[model samples]
Target chain A: MKVRSHRAGKLLKGLWLALVLAFLYIPIIVMIALSFNASVSRAAWTGFTLDWYVKLFKSKQIMAALNVTITVAVIATVVSTVLGTLGAIGMHAMSTGMANLLINVSYLPMTTPDIVTGVSLMLMFIFVKVPLGKWTMIMAHIAFDTPYVLFSVMPKLRQMNPNLYEAALDLGCHPAKALYKVIIPEIMPGIVTGALLAFTMSLDDFVISYFTSNTDQNLAMIVYSAARRGVEPTMYALSTLMFIVVLGLLLIVNRRNGLEDIA
Target chain B: MKRSWYAAPYGVWMVLFTVVPLLFVLYYAFTDQSGAFTVNNFVKIASPMYGLVLWDSLRLAFFCTLLCLLIGYPTAYFLASRDFSNAQTLVVLILVPMWMNFLLRTYAMMTLFENNGVINTLLESLGLERIQMIGTEGAVLVGMVYNFLPFMVLPVYTVLKKMDYSVIEAAEDLGASPIRVVSRVVLPMSIPGVVSGITMVFMPAVTTFAISRMLSSGMIYLVGDMIEDYFIAMNNRNVGSTISLVMLVLIILSIGLLRKVDPDNTGGGLW
Candidate 1:
């Protein structure tokens, strides 16, 4: 009786998880499905159509917004990855207390509300006030993204064998040579993961970009302004494309590492 | 020859950019128009309208946190408890939405909730009429849960994963029933994650201007909306700065209290 019931419980648990997974995914599936539906009305499927996707290519404003978002994300990610990795290495080299303090201070910006971050950055711009534009957006992204990259890289840094660097130095290698040849190679995985995270984060941002962004628009901000009247077909097309890009990138990274998920 | 040249450019960048700007925001938050530092800006929080904004913030945060807990807790437990090799893929799949554009996600939801949208049309077909799910306070809550569910789930899963299965095995061997074991042991062990998830969900729900705007159609004024209106639309920076300070204080206090209550939160482990 006990064994039978245990088996039953296990079956129940599996079913429950399956159901939960379905619930988690169905909404996104609905969005993707509707984006492809030939019929405009989600109420009834009229037929199959690629016009929505095609229409997206014809829109200049959307193309501009897409360009802006991509550029900002690319710049922000590259800058943050370098700063953050170095910051992580610096923390690793430091004593424990200072390292902890620096790490904590660096991550504080991430915890604050986007509104606070946006307004604060905007005010900062206004005070000394450079023009709020692409650069300001990059500035804000770096401010927050550094900590994320640091945290991602720190564990891998800690995991690395210190003697490799020491051995290189003992062999008469320069400090730069030791760092570039030894320390950086060990921490590449962490750095890459952090860069990916930063890229997605900068791409998905709204409130900060909304405030600090000059007359330009990112994908998210454009969707916001367009959704004001009604969701444009192009918004669906663009989001679907972005969703595909995100999935494809993650899959590529996962496949390269041969890991199903980041642990 | 320069220690400053290449040793820490990010530090220089942050100092010139982030740190300097942050201090200026703090200065603005404290000072009045005449350059005199006063608590009057902070005192403006006592106004009834701002008071309502605070209340609205708390209500939204509390409910959104609760809703996420209701959905995410079960989902997380299921994910954590599973031993199947394929489960990690499903977990990752669930989290993929976390990377999607916030505005696009909101737009997708708007399609489902709008008057001529999916949910209503289905309801009408089912002989239900005028459900009023959109443009109400409920729509805002739905929007929030839709966005923040993964945030809550991920943290809770972290906790659930850390919990020792041996505790459950021991409890069962001691003759406690399954439900009893879960309530008495599993639930207790997950409090730290619960606190973290609640704060993660609550902070955004309270501060979010986008969902409230997109779903509620500006008819449902949230505290975040009010703050935006003051600073951006109305140019009432004095009052806006005051409210932001007040909110920062409240968040700090709440987080402190939450951390204090959760005995295991002191561990510097990130989920």
Candidate 2:
């Protein structure tokens, strides 16, 4: 009797998990299916075709938005990663009170709702009379992205031997040379992880970009506006392509660092 | 290069972008059109129109959080309890959807709920009448839950995975049923995760504008939508800033209260 009950419980758990996964993935699956469908009718499956994917590449609006998204992501990732790594190192050497102050300030951006962050940054740009455009978006992205980089690098800094940099210096290494040879290598993993995170966040960002951008629309902004107008098969093609790329990238990262790092 | 000086650039950036922008929010929140100090912006939310939007936001967010917890708790518990082959892959599956552009996924959801979309189409083929899924409160709630469900799952799963299994065995040895063991021992230990998950899910669900806009077809208005409209559509920065401030205060207050419940402070480990 107990054995049967145990088996039944296991079945129940499996069923529940299956239901939840279905809930999560069904819409995504539908989108993928629709991407290849020749007909716009959801009820009927027409002949398979890649026409939408062809159109996706040919669309100037999408191409422009994609270009802007990649450009902003690359610039934001580089700037934030550099600034954040240096900041983390500097904070590691600071007085506890001073570091705490900066840490608290960092949390404000990290924890605040994106809408508030978006709104406030928009106001700031308007107040300072900076024209709203890609540069402003990059600045806003850097503001939010730096804290994640700092936090990621901070843990690695904590784990490193405190004397590693000083020992390099004692061994006749110049200050910059010591930093390059010892400090940076020690924190390289964190820096890479932080940079990847910054890149992804900037690429996926919509709310802040929406508020800050005047004429410069990223892929997300374009997708939002397009989705609002109507569902387009071209969007499904774009989503499917992005989904595959993101999945492949994540799998590669997972293989390198183990699933725990990203998840 | 001195170590302290390394952070000077970061400090400057933070002050310029982070600190100064927040100050702008405060400035606009407290000032009127001429920039003189005034509380009129705060007073404006007292009207029934804005009040209903706030209430709708809280209601939808509340239900979304509750449903996520209900579904997510079991999924996490089961995943952690059973020794599944390739458990790491299962967790990865949960996260892959998130890496897809947030706007795209929400848009995908809209297609499923549209009048002639996949779900209704399927119903029709099954010889059932088509149902109106979009532009409803239920649709908005589903959208919120769908978008934020992973936030509810990951933290709880992390906590449960770290929980020692021997405690459950001990409780069972003491004549506790499996349910009793879970309820008595496992549940208390997972409170930290639950707390953090609630905060994570609730924050985004409450603040979301686009999900509600797309899923509800503009029938629903949340605080986020209001903020977006004021700043973008109406160009009323003062009122927008005022609403943003109020939202911020509510969020901070709830986070504080959640921290009080999970006194050990392990609740926010997701950060």
Candidate 3:
């Protein structure tokens, strides 16, 4: 009886594990499988077809949207990467309540809901007479994306040995040169990861882009407008494309961060 | 010690973007561009629609948070204690879904749960043809739980992994059953994780409009939905900002209340 009960318990545990993982992945799996469904209509799975892939390349709007998204994401990533690194470095010199306050405020954008962030930032930008275009979108993204970059780098910045910089200084290196030579090398991982994170945020962001985009700004806005038009048959293609990109990003980040670290 | 020309660029970005936008929020919170320094916007948020919407938002958010806690705790404990060769795979599985736009997920959920979608079709194939899943509170819950699962898992997993196994071993040595050990020992130790998980899920769930809009078929207008209407539909920045200020106050008060759980106030429940 004891042996039977122990076997049953193990079986039950296995059942629970299967059930949970299946529950999490079922939608994603269904979506991926249907991407190959010859029917472009996500409304149903009629047949298997790859014609959507062919048509995906034919749409100029999708291409334009893709261009805007890539351009905007690249710019935002570069800007946020630079400022965030500097901010993290600048923060190391100050060990005060002010630093903590600045850190918290920097993170407010990360915590605040996207709708509020989008609307408020849009209003602020408009009121300030900053024209709402690609630049405004970049500015808005930078406001929020910097926090992620800062969060990624700040702790790593704090952990580095100050003596390395001191040693560089002693060798007659200028402060900027010491920063470039010593500080940069020490925090390379943080910088790379932070930039990747910023890029992800830029690429995936919807709320800010929705509020700030004009006729020609980002892919998220394009997808939104397309969906509003009764689920553009091409939207599923766009979604499938997005899934691949995000999945690729996930794999890359996981390998970089290491499985043990994520666990 | 020499601040370069680059300092000016940093200073300019800070002023033009972060510092100014925040100051703009504060200044707008007080002003009355409805032509005078009046409190009319604050009064407008007191309307029945706003009140109902706020109540709706709170109700849905609480339910979502409760669901997350129930689903997340065991999963977090199991994952945190495991020695898997590919835990990264599992973490990424939970995380990758979040990278897609929220709007896309909401729309995809509609396709799955709608009357003509897979769930019903599957149910019909299985001989239960009378079930309704979409355009209901259940659909809202599904969306919230789906989107916010990672938020709950990440913090709780972080905390649970840090819990000392020796404490549990001590309990076991004292002749406590696994059930008693968990309830009395492990759960209490994970309060910070629980707190953070709840906060992370609750904050966004309460303010989300897209989920409600995409799933609810207009029968339900959450506070988030109401706030969206105020700004986008009615063109009432005054009322929208007022509601934001009120929500901000409520959120701050909630944070203060939760802080009482931490003796030292070292960090939030999640941190």
Residues B1-271 of candidate 2: C-alpha lDDT, one tens digit per residue? 5788899999999999888988899999999988999999988898999999999999999999999999999888888885576666777788677677778788889889899998898898899999998999999898888888888889999999999998888898899987798889999999999999999899988899999999987988899999999999999999999999999999999999999999877852467
For model 3, name the residue pairs that clash. Answer: A38-A47, A38-A48, A38-A49, B196-B270
Q: What DockQ does every candidate get?
A: 0.51, 0.78, 0.42
Question: Model 3 misses residue A127 by how many Å?
Answer: 0.9
Q: Write the per-residue lDDT of candidate 3 for residues A14-55, one digit (tens) a residue.
A: 565466677666766666666577765454678877777667
Top model number, lDDT:
2
Best-to-worst ranking by lDDT: 2, 1, 3
Best by DockQ: 2
Classified by CAPRI criteria, candidate 3 counts as acceptable
Worst 10 residues of 3 chain A by lDDT: A254-263
Candidate 1 structure quality by residue, lDDT tens digits, B1-271: 2212232665666666556666766787788877678778767778897788789879988989998888888778878875456767766877777767667777788888888888888899999894766689888888888888878877778788878899888998999997898799988888888888888888888888888889978878887887788777887666777777678778888988889868668321233
> Model 1 chain B, poorest ten-residue lDDT window?
B1-10
Candidate lDDT scores, in order, read 0.77, 0.88, 0.72
DockQ score for model 3:
0.42
- At residue A56, candidate 2 shows an lDDT of 94
For all predictions, the C-alpha RMSD in Å is 2.7, 1.4, 2.8
